[model samples]
Target: MVQEKQSDRQQRLDNFLQAVEAAQKVQDDIMKYGLEAAHLYCDDIDGDWLETWEEDEDGQQSFVELVTNFLQSDDLVAVKVRKQLKDKSLQEIAVNLEKCLSLSEEDDRIFAVKKVLLRGVAVAESNRGTSSDEIDEIELLDLAEELLDKLAEFLVSINR
Candidate 1:
């Protein structure tokens, strides 16, 4: 039982790290390519994810369909959320943003399902939450880092 628990924690850690790296790439892509290219990126923050998926075949190509669906679905959701926040008050804005987090959880679960199908293990942490809209690049990056920190903490607790 102990061994199984440790293994689960390790798997979750690996998955979390991979996601953080992916999120970081998304941020960098937006910063480097500008938001205009975001469409080319298929809703990947700026365009980092699309570039990574296209250029990096280390293990992503095999899951092209999965990644594409995740990106596009997420991007579509982002577009809608951006529109809804146009008239919300400060408090309402926060609530509306929280409604947008289904995509993140969707992305994570899709990745985890793929991993489980291939490796017989589900490593992705199932987390879901919403966020505010029109968040600038720096804010997006900070949010990404905050998520990474939170995931790492989850990993630590699971390890025990």
Candidate 2:
């Protein structure tokens, strides 16, 4: 029994270390490419996901699709954050953003990644709450800027 327990623990530790290494690789990618680095982890994204904000006659992507993609992503960061924050309302999302900001201040790489994903979730939730008419052109632009700022902060944190 003791030997079996020891073996199990060793296996668990090995899996954890492997996960950490993979997360570090992801952090390196994020450092190099900012938020666009998501494409690196998400090669399986479909044609719909490729659609941009622009209104091309052949393709159309809404905020709903983007948010759904984030929620469904299998990337380590997204998976971990989804496990941590199941269903967040706009107000809860604000609290999570503040928590993420605090976590980002830490020196840990894992925390940095977690904070970035948390912020992403918060932004997605905020966007999900809005109707097309409720959020005018300016609000959409502002949201994009805010996402960029969060990505910049995340890159800085990981670089440190």
Candidate 3:
């Protein structure tokens, strides 16, 4: 019976590890495709007017497709993991924030901004209502704004 119990525990551990690995792979793929699409879009925009214009349509279409697939797959995995975890630990929240800031477009950046802000508000409210820990709501809001600014700057540099 003890041996059987041990084997069952091991199997559960193995399953958890596999799930984490799968989640990481999804995150990596999302970043890879997102960055690639950003690069392609940036390149097609920042060049001689006629040359860039000629290639813009096809490049934009390809970039859009890549981004669409990445978002759908990555968001699905993210939602699943977030649901499973229930509480978003600081590390997990940071990872998601980083991914959001890496997006190149204003609309994409806004999505990330909204996510972080929403998370911050939720965290703050929960903490305030429950415990007396000094949770700095202003700090959390500042961090989100900083991320948005950094992403905007990066995008501007790509355009220039």
TM-score of each: 0.26, 0.30, 0.27
How much does candidate 2 score in TM-score?
A: 0.30
Candidate 1: where is the Cα deviation over 4 Å?
Answer: 43-160
- After superposing candidate 3, which stretches have Cα over 4 Å from the reference? 1-90, 102-104, 129-143, 151-160
RMSD vs true structure, all candidates: 23.0, 20.5, 21.4
Give the Cα RMSD of candidate 2: 20.5
Tens digits of per-residue lDDT, candidate 3, 1-160, equal: 9999999999999999999997887677667896564454455555576644523433442222333233334454334334333555535554565577668786666666566556645665575584524545454445456545644544454344
In model 3, residue pairs whose N, Cα or C atoms come closer than 3 Å (at least 3 residues apart or on different chains), thus clashing, are none
lDDT of each: 0.43, 0.53, 0.54
Answer with 2 or 3, whichever has the higher TM-score. 2
In model 1, the number of clashes is 3
Better candidate number, 1 or 2, judged by TM-score: 2
* Candidate 2: residue pairs that collide: none
Better of 1 and 2 by lDDT: 2
CA displacement after TM-score superposition, residue 86 of candidate 3 (Å): 16
Clashing pairs counted in every model: 3, 0, 0
Candidate number with greatest TM-score: 2
Per-residue lDDT of candidate 1, residues 43-128 (tens digit): 55654665566433454332233332322344543333333233333334333223333345745534432222222111111111
The deviation in Å at residue 122 for candidate 1 is 60
